[model samples]
Target: MEKEEIIYGAHSVIEALKSEKSIEKIILNKGQRNEFYEEITQLAKEQQVKVSFVPQVKFRKYENLNHQEIIAFTSPVKFADFETIIESILSKKESVLFLVLDGVTDVRNLGSIIRTAECTGVDAIILPKNNSAGVNKDTVKTSAGAIFKIPICKVDHVHDALFYFQSSGIQLIAATEKTDNYIYNQEVNAKVALVMGDENKGISNATLKQVDAKVKLPLLGSIESLNVSVACGAMLYEIVRRKTQ
Candidate 1:
């Protein structure tokens, strides 16, 4: 029983093999042979992605549909280069928008953020390659397939990406209750990256130190904190309203 997220269809798997997607493994039907078989095997070998051959009985779940005789269990989100995606976006849009996740380790939270980010026209999502939930089955499910719609940059450090964003003339706004500044007070009409931190710890002091501003959504409830996704959606929609209206 494979437990990872699966992407079937020869075109989909072939594109994944050609890109920088983290493909955990590929399974081929031993009884099936087609023109794409050689291409898929060669690309997988070149990318050093693991491939497995099994009987067609293993694909019983997908027998009713056209899976193109191939299955690829992969991290469906392809990571873009931090510098390259930034430069590319800046080249076209004078006012850009981005989201930064600081050690958000929950896959579902990450997915929800991705969904909101996509809906709000976020240029890309920056995440630390380490200590992050990243894309997975639950993430994809939570995002309602929005994971594939947005550009994601997996970098070595959150600080590095923040610094780069600043150098590129984009502002960094940290979303946290640590500050008195509210989301509505901040100006996100220009190029900016909204930074959200971990669920328990909030924004790290180290990360907060580098942000241009620290802002938070007003809380009237008894609780001091909100779920990361809900807070993020509120903040992003505020930005969207500012940018659009």
Candidate 2:
């Protein structure tokens, strides 16, 4: 992370939150409640920014800096507005191809997925602002500069985004190991949004219930599942193949 990307101190953090800055996460000193605690918590809740409570000793790492018990990490990339982007896509009368991620916290996995999504001609990538990984220096490096080419939207919740896509006439397809249906059997040529989940847990039950179709890649090896990035590539290429043929 860059130095300019970090904002600390109580008043400064609160102002940033109020101004609707793209905050990746906020770290608060554990067991230290101040006058601004309630206000900060409420603002974070409203903005859907993840907060982590850590020991005071963690603040010692910042020499010659007064953190005031709170620090907010700002995202390196500016997030595009989902509604605006969707409206533009629809105005153009183009088939919608979105990559929606649920609870995917791994930075590298997120970067890899973005890289593949761009190459596969996905319209945009959407993720929840609180639980998902934010684009940063490491993500940019891992993506090999693909992060700049693709538009990323960080919303408050993935379920809400799924509903928005469905209302706009896009089908939702989820990739999970729990599914008996294979990816090859699905029809991907129409307006569709492909949903990928976390590394350990597959799609959350709430989000799974909203999907129009759930498909899985066959696992013939001893391993039961593939890495999220590899699985994402497999699914995306399958969509491309179906569209062409």
Candidate 3:
């Protein structure tokens, strides 16, 4: 990570948090309890920033510098405001085509999805603030710079975003293996949000409830399911095909 992408020292991290910077994660000395520790923890929680506690040995790389038992990594890309982007898309009277990700942590998969979404002309990609991969160097590279070209929105809770999209007349179509409905059989040409879930867990039951339709890709071979990225591509291209036809 670049020096500008990282904030070191307790005071610096606390200030960054106070300023509501887009911090990816914070690392602190494992057993060291300092005066600013509680304040940092509180601020991180309020900002929904992930905090990790590492051993003193882990700080050896910073031995030459004064890290003050704290380091925070800021996201390289600025996240978009979901509501603002949605409003703008609606104002243009354009059909909303959004890709909502739930608990997708792999940077490569996230990158591929972003690349595919951009190629597919998706309006925006929505992700939950927690448990989703942030736009970092690896993700950016994996996306072939598509991350910069697309509007990525991180929300506090994906379910809330689903609710808001539904209220705005965007049909929520969930891609899952648990459903009997197949994507080829569904109507996806209209304003819709395509939801892809965690690689292992699929869609959460609570989230599944909010979707207007749950569709799955048919697996006729030995493999039970396709990779998340490939499934996303198949689903998105299907939408493109439907719109064109």
- Candidates arranged by lDDT, highest first: 3, 2, 1
How does candidate 1 fare on TM-score? 0.72
The model with the greatest TM-score is: 3
Stretches > 4 Å off in candidate 1: 1-74
lDDT digits (tens) for residues 67-95 of candidate 1: 87799987666678889988999999987
Better of 2 and 3 by TM-score: 3
Quote each prediction's TM-score. 0.72, 0.93, 0.95
Write model 3 residue lDDT over 1-245, tens digit each, in one string: 22228889988989999999889888899889999889999999987888889998988887776889798888888888989988998889667689999989998999999999999999899999888876677888889989888888999999999999989989899999888998989987579999999988888999999999999999999988889999999999998888778
Task: Please report how far candidate 2 places residue 212 from its true position, in Å.
Answer: 1.6
Q: Supply candidate 3's per-residue lDDT for 18.
A: 98
TM-score ranking from best candidate downward: 3, 2, 1
Q: List candidate 3 stretches off by more than 4 Å.
A: 1-4
True-structure RMSD, every candidate: 7.9, 2.0, 1.9
